[model samples]
Structure formats: C-alpha cells, structure tokens
Target: MTHTENTRVAVNGYGVIGKRVAAAVAAQDDMTLAGVADVATDWRVAVARAKGYPLFGATLEHVRAMTEAGLDPAGSLDDLLGAADVVVDCTPKKVAAGNVERYRERGIKFIVQGGEKHAVTGHSFTAENNYDTALGRQSTRVVSCNTTSTVRTLSALKQAGLLKKARGVLIRRATDPWESHLGGIMNTLVPEADIPSHQGPDAQTVDPELDVVTMAVKAPETLSHLHYWTVQLTREASKDEVLGALRASSRIAFIRMADGLVALNSVKELMADLGRPHDNLYEVAVWEDMLTVQGDEAFYAYMVDNQAIVIPETIDAIRALTEIEADGATSIEKTNEALGITGRLVPEPVAA
Candidate 1:
C-alpha cells in the first residue's frame, strides 16, 4: 500500500461512533482507515472485520479472547497506532483519557470524543468553531453530539451578528438505539441534576464567547435528541433572515414538517430513503417552518442524530490535526461533498 498523500487514521473503538467514523474516514479521498481496535468480538466488531478494516486488540488479554473467538486480530492497539498518522479515540467514557498517555508516549496525534473532560486534550474542537486552533496540533477533543449541533447553530447566528443570548431545553435520547435493549429509561424522564446542564458548558469549550445556557432531560425513545431554543437576537429579525443566517453554515440543514418530516423518526426514515450510509443525518435537522420570530426573540427546534452528528466534525478534526488541509472551509466542503451533506434533505417538499 502506498502512503503518498493520504492520512492513515486508526480508530480505537468499533462501537457506534467508531463504526461511523471508520466508514467516514474510509470515504475520504485524502485519508485511509488504517484499522479499528476494540476488545469485543461481537457483531459490531465483526461488522468492521466484514468491511475489511484491520482488527486489533486493545490489550493482550483482549487479543487472546478475540483469537479464541475466531476473530483474527492483527495485533494489539499499539500496532494499530504504529501504522497510522493519527488515531481517533472513540472508546467509552473515561477510557479514552486513560489511553492518552499511551498515545503521547508514541508521539502519535490523537483525537478523543467529548466523553472525556476538556482537560484531557486542553483544547476542544467543533470544526466550524475552532479548526485553526487545532491545526498542526498533536491532539484535540471533539465536543459531544449535542455540543456539536449547538455550536454549529449558534456560531452561525453569532457570525451573522444576530446572537445576543440563548436559552435552550434539550430532550435527549435515553441511549443509542443499538444499546436500548441493554438498559434505558421506561415510561419516564430523567433530568440532568443541574440547571444549565453540562452541554451548555461543553459548548462553551468550543466557543467561549457565546452566551448560552441549557437544560436537558432524557426521554424514553432512542431516535434522536430534540432541542428547543429561545434566542434573543442582537436586534429584531425576520424568520427569513434568521433562516438565511443558519443556512450560511453548510452543516445546518432545514427540514420542514410540511414535507412529512413531522418528527424525529420521520427524519430518520428520510435518511434511509435518501440512501445515507448507516441512515446517518450528518446535518442538524432544524425545522424550517416551525421556527418563529417575535420582535427580537426567535424560537426554533432541531433534531440531533446522536450517533451521526459528530462524525463530520471528527472527520474535519482529522484533517486539522494532520494539516492535510489548512483552511477549515475547504476541509468542511470536502467532507460535506464526500458525505453528501446538502443543506436540504428532501429536494421537493412532500405534500402532507
């Protein structure tokens, strides 16, 4: 295999996000999926193997277990890292932080998911908000799914000089759909213990100047997250102006309930109908018709595909860390093109 102009990317987990990241990385013209490493021999990891990603064990014990299970892993995690230019740590919460020392010891550039604290990388990333800060940097933490959508939407308004302060309520999914059978809430809601829940602060890590506060509660379903925001604009603005401001960012897509995307599940179904890989909704699905403006206040709601939203940001972060693309817009445009992320999902509005 020749490594002339591509960045070799090793993914540290093959779970929900890892599997998606692996696929996205393999789709890029300037990046290569070196392999995926995980301790499991279940269907998830098996799928990666089926897709022809080189397998690796996170530990010697894992290697033995995988071998016993007939999953032929190439080697340990270190072997995977040694073969790549950069690694994306998609391990579960707190686990990726523990792997940081290993990555640094090998002088490998790495990116961690939002599960870990900002202190883990000392710099948090959302492609549009902070790409240059991560340029040529050894490491960065891609903020979680919720934070990614929040930053993308708010940054759009901020850039247009329409943002003053935002107060939002997030109805979060209980768990990834794949893991719902394991354990999740039933017929009830679980609210985050604190007001201005951690998501608000997490978004701040990506853009500190944005005046935003959030409250979140977990719902029973796993389709996706719903965020309703009441934003105080810098001045009174019309719906079209606000929509245009949001439309400026390529990652924010407008979906209309009038087009039969009345709910999150409907939107997910649309993704499958559109032939999106893994039925992924890479853009923040803001309801175009549902948004309203009253004087200087604007209200809107959007759906966040928890499993898929962060995938693009992670892709952009890969380019930023590797310096494969110097301009953030170029990296975003390339990623969006490869992933088929047009600002509109349904080309023609469906008649209700």
Candidate 2:
C-alpha cells in the first residue's frame, strides 16, 4: 500500500491499551498504523497481526517467537520506532520508566498511558482539560482512567459556569477484567486511608484549575469502576440544567435505569449488543437518573470502564502531538467520529 501524509503511529505494547490504541489509530482518517510490538507469546501478537498491524517484537527473542507463530514480525522494538513518527507505550507500569528513557534517548515522539507518573512526559493530557498544553509535546502522558473521568466531568461543568468544587469516591474494581490470574479481595478494601486518594492530585495533574478531592474503596466487581461525585456549584442548578450540559458535552455519555440497563452488567450487555470493539464503552457513563441538585450542591454517579474510556484520549494525544488538530473540540470530534463515538450509547429513558 502506498503511504500518504497521515501521521504514522506505532504501539509499543499489545496489552489492553496498546491493542485499543492501535485499533483507534487504524480507524482515524488522519493517522496510520505503523506497527505494534509486544513481548513474546502473548497470543495478542497474532491478534495484532490478524488486525493487519505490522507486528514488531518487544525484544529480539520475541521477534523469533512471533515469527515461529507465523505472525512474521517486522523487527524488534528499535525497528518499530525507526519506521514510525510516534510510539504509544502501553506496557505495564514496571516496564514504563525504561521505555520512557528509550523514547527520550531516541528523540522519538511518544505518548505514555496513565500508569506512569505525570513527569513521565511532563505533559499530562486530558483533551477536555488541557489539549492545547499537550500540542507538539515530545512526550505526552494520557492521565489514568479514573483521573480522566474526574477531569472530564469537571471540565464540562466548569465551562458551563455551574461548578465550584467537587469531592468524589472512586469505587474501583479490584483488578482488570483480563487479569484472571490474580485473585481479588472478597471484601471491600480501602487501599488509601488518606482523606483524598491519589486520584484527586492526579486529576490536578490534568486540570489544576479544577478543585477536586477524591477517595477510593475497592469493590469485588471487575465490570467497571463506579464513582460518586458531590459537587458544589457556583449557583443553583436544576437536574434538567445539569443533564442539558452533559448531553451537550463532547465526551460524556449518560445511561439511566429507565433505559432497561440499570446496573453495570446490563451496561456491558448493551455494549456487546452494539458490537463494540472488545465490548468497550469508550465514554464515561454518567447516570442521568442520579443527577441531583439541592441549593447549589449537586450529586452525580458514574462509571468508568478501565479497558475502554482512555482510548479516545490517547487518540487525541496523538493528534495534539502531531499538530494535526490544535483545538481540543476539533480533535475530540474527529477522534470520536472516526471511532463512531456519537451521542449517548444507552437507549433513551423509557417514559416514566
């Protein structure tokens, strides 16, 4: 195939985020899937190859193994970078620091997932909050999924002139859905005794202007990470006003019990029914039925799918770094349209 002027994007790891990012790049009209690399024998290497991504091995040995598996990778990690404009490093947390150093040494453009510290790239990205700041960044860090939701909800409300401060509780899943080898706690666990969990400060990494404090507890469910938000608004708001704002926002998707998919399980069912890639709901699922307002104080409940919500942000980061789209809304809309992320994924609430 003849290459055009599209920005070439290589995915450095074929784990959850890497696979998703690679697919997203393939879907983008302005981007091309240069290649993807992963460690040896990950099964997903074949998945990448089946998806038509030029497979590269994370190590030389991985290359040989994948070649035996008939994926016939292009080369090793170095070769992947040599052929690409940008690398999206989606390796595990323990592997990220070393990868970050390599990207820096090679003078290659890269975007790291939220697992790493904000300093990993020195440009924490959440398109709704700081798209312009990340434009042309040599190293970009897409904030973690939890922080992504907090920042997105806050950014839209702040822009609507209806928010003051927010305090949230992150009901985190005990483990990633694909992590079946690791057993999760049967009882609820509070990993952080601190009044505000690290996510509050992490959200600040993306939106320092938005005042947010967060706490966390772990639930047994691996389906989704649920969050409860209590926000103080600058002025009184009605439920309709809040819903109107969210319905108008670019990245927010609302689902309610009236839609006949009240709980998280049924939500996943809906995504599966829609034939979503990997059954992923890429948007932060806000519960419209839970939006409550009382005398300038409002409460909201939402869920973030760990495997999915961050995909769009990573795509936006690529465009921002490549200077293809300077405006957040434009980049976000382009990415959303390319990925088929239109209006709310849930059906409209049945007449109550």
lDDT of all predictions, in order shown? 0.94, 0.85
Candidate RMSDs in order: 2.1, 2.6
- Model 2: per-residue Cα lDDT over 1-352, one tens digit each: 1234889898988887888888889999989899988885766777777777898888898889888887888999999898888899999985877887788888889998888998767789988778888887898889898998888888888888988999998999888888855877776675667878989999888777878899898888788899999999999889888778776677788888887767888889999998899898888889888789998998989888889899999999988888877788999999889887887795557897
What does candidate 1's lDDT look like per residue over 209-312, in tens digits?
98999999999999899999999999999999999999999999999988888999999999999999989999999999999999999999999999999999
Candidate 1, superposed: residue stretches over 4 Å from native: 1-4, 349-352
For residue 62, model 2's alpha carbon misses the true position, in angstroms, by 1.9
State in Å the error of residue 25, model 2.
Answer: 0.7
Candidate number achieving the greatest lDDT relative to the actual structure: 1
Lowest summed lDDT window (length 10), candidate 1: 1-10
RMSD of 1: 2.1
Give the Cα error of residue 121 in candidate 1, in Å.
0.4
lDDT of 2: 0.85
TM-score of each: 0.97, 0.95
Error of 1 at 172 (Å): 0.5
